[model samples]
Target: MFTLPHHIEFLSDRWVEEGRKFLVGEAPKIRERPAPAERLRGRPLSVSGRFTQAPPHMNLPRDVGCFSVHFDGEAFAVTTSFDPAADLVIEGDYQAALTGAQMVGIAAPGAFRTLRREIDHLYGPEALKVRGAIADPMALEVLSGLFDHLGRKTVENPDLAHRAARQGLSGKIREMEAQGYTIVENAITPEFADEARETILRTLSMHGHQTMNWMLYHGRALERLALNPSLMTLIDASLGRGAVIASLSCIRRGAGPGFIPIHTDYSHVPEPYPAFAMTGVGVWAFEDWTEASGPTVLVPGSHRARRHPRSSDDPGAGVPIVMPKGSVVFFTEGVWHWQGDRTEAGERVTLHSHFNRGILRSLEARRIDEQMIYRNPPRLGEMLGEDDWFEKTTAAGRDYMRFNYMRQLLAFNEAGKQAILAEPQAAAPTKSARRAVPA
Candidate 1:
């Protein structure tokens, strides 16, 4: 397994040191590019960055929230101080700056355009500010290349590996691959589950509705649960990165016959579905799920059929997924499923988190609220489609920074999934061997 030496928080001192080393190592490659090489033939270039209002969890020092990069034609050096005489100075909200720095693999021609578009259209003018100018516009491209190189080594989904190991998710991932669905028992604490249930009930009462869409905007609990690390790892493995929120909905159902019919999630698609997955869902159980309490039932290994269930198919073959409170059942790859009848329950409450591949349109229209983005970490924004380049356009062209960002993110997510699957599964100890060991 590939394990990081230590957790490197974004924009921390360690992140800066690692970024410096990465830039130093990539200096030679940057010089090989003809246009950038010619642009920096003789003149030295310097750029400084300043960020403020960093989230408390980031642990960045208030006084040292700045860094400068200096390139002396052939070599590069990074320092933890502002450069008053630098050719360019970029300043912005700490989170917004992190967003800009995380965009990797952007082409030189679209670098400046991407930055300008993000500042004006996405982050707002007050969120990002740029000062000073270079005589040669090509310098922006060279600097952009340097930043991209650094970002490749630094910014990443930091919790994926540790969370997977902590939750023992490798076997779950394998199970999901083989059966098209998996249940993670006690994915959250019972206390949290109760809190989420109460929040949902309150929202339902306020809105006078049995079901609510856009539940992520309803409460903090929904937001946190929606971006659960373990659930996200599974989604990343199945849907690839840059997957946007298709819907975050809550349902309050009383004792009655199952209303939803047996079907696949892939609506309007032709038969013999493609090998790749298009959509996935993680249904959260707010209370213990029993066969009679109304649980989601699915046909095991049916995804391998690669088609929807026919009327002749036996619904009796489906098995109910029974799990404890705070658990979640994740199903993908167009699995055939339906809600079971509720005979014993007062009410069955569930929060459904549905996600689609980056290339597909979402079921719920995105409402890009700035306060919501500001309150949560970049992960929440990412699921809300803030990080990817979609539905964004200008008279000049598309946002290449986000376009390239999604490409790089998807590649990284796939590689990480493979690594998780490659890990060796530990064997259970034999009875005699267990007896020989000391208690």
Candidate 2:
């Protein structure tokens, strides 16, 4: 018992007809490659729902109708409706339906610029098929091939392997290389961990919410905790010669559906699933990570798995990262992981620092003003990205800065830096030069 606005159905008919022509190979090919409007030349769409549009941040509509149809590329007639008999049932805000409709090529362009920016981050080369499938039904086999090409699953990219091998790895580093992660027990002094724990708890009371970018707010103590020398060495070992901090935040586990779901932190970057660690995470435990306390879980050796875990897969295959307070866990970005469900009554807290290979973008926004940079120690300022602007602008400039910083940080000896600098550009394995390790 639902119907659409009269105008929406008429407009939908035009788009749907266009979609059908593209799918049937009847539409003429233009100079543009993979154009969505061109492909959906004659597809008919039918949806049933009544939705209200908000100025921004829309919600899902109730009841389904033709006007409620969203854009989806898998089929030529991409549609959505909650009319019980509709193809898809959206349960949230009507604005979400509008957004999805626009995303798949439905709806008008009222606020699509902001939505497109988010879409770019969500849909990369691997998932670009929605556009392709909508554009060319004949591209099914080609799309399959594209997905295969994107997954370069192997132990490690040899160039990064060579670089890591050259670091004169300690036993811990070697273990990390073999297992994809390593837990450094008692890496931090008890007194230091206690102080950091106190700081986090005090800050948590003021913030009320669980996780936050607590580093800047707490001042020098939190900064010192994040820049612990031993932890940085381990991080740099895997992140190659010039890794820098991308974000510094805290995650406090709470009792709910779980604070964070099981997932990899690797989707932020574009890629052909690099065989090395492009991003690394360092978690300094402020309290014990016990089974009851809902510790973080990691799938052993999954860092090399170029694909993400599907819903049907077994989550129990992962092992919890259990360690004492004051210990630290370091892991490569690609590893499939999620925070464990907290069955206990209280909460557990951990300070996390995400480090990225200098070439990648930072996870959080940062400003490198002179006053702020000069206030911190030179080494700390470097991690805070004081010199990042020069590295981000041009290719040659980035290389020059990377080499210089690596030399200063002692990421490599003088001879090692010289050897790396002399190599042909193609000889470097993946663009990300660090290897994967476990936590």
Prediction RMSDs, each to the true structure:
14.7, 24.4
Cα shift from native, residue 238, model 2 (Å): 1.3
lDDT of 1: 0.72
After superposition, candidate 2 runs with Cα above 4 Å error: 1-169, 270-272, 369-376, 388-439
- The models' CA-based lDDT, in order, is 0.72, 0.51
Tell me each candidate's TM-score: 0.64, 0.52
lDDT of 2 by residue, 1-439 (tens): 0001111211133333433444333445422455443344344332334433221111223222233333344443333323434343333223233223322111224323433433332222222112111233434322222212211110011122232332222444555555566676666556667878778878877879677873654754575566454455566566753457778888776765566777877864554468667888878877777777787788877776666667887887687787778778787847778887777787688888888876677777765655444333333554655433444556444544434544444433333333443443332222112222223
Kindly give the stretch of ten consecutive residues in candidate 2 with the minimal lDDT sum. Answer: 1-10
Model 2's C-alpha root-mean-square deviation from the true structure amounts to 24.4
Per-residue error at 393 for model 1, in Å? 2.1
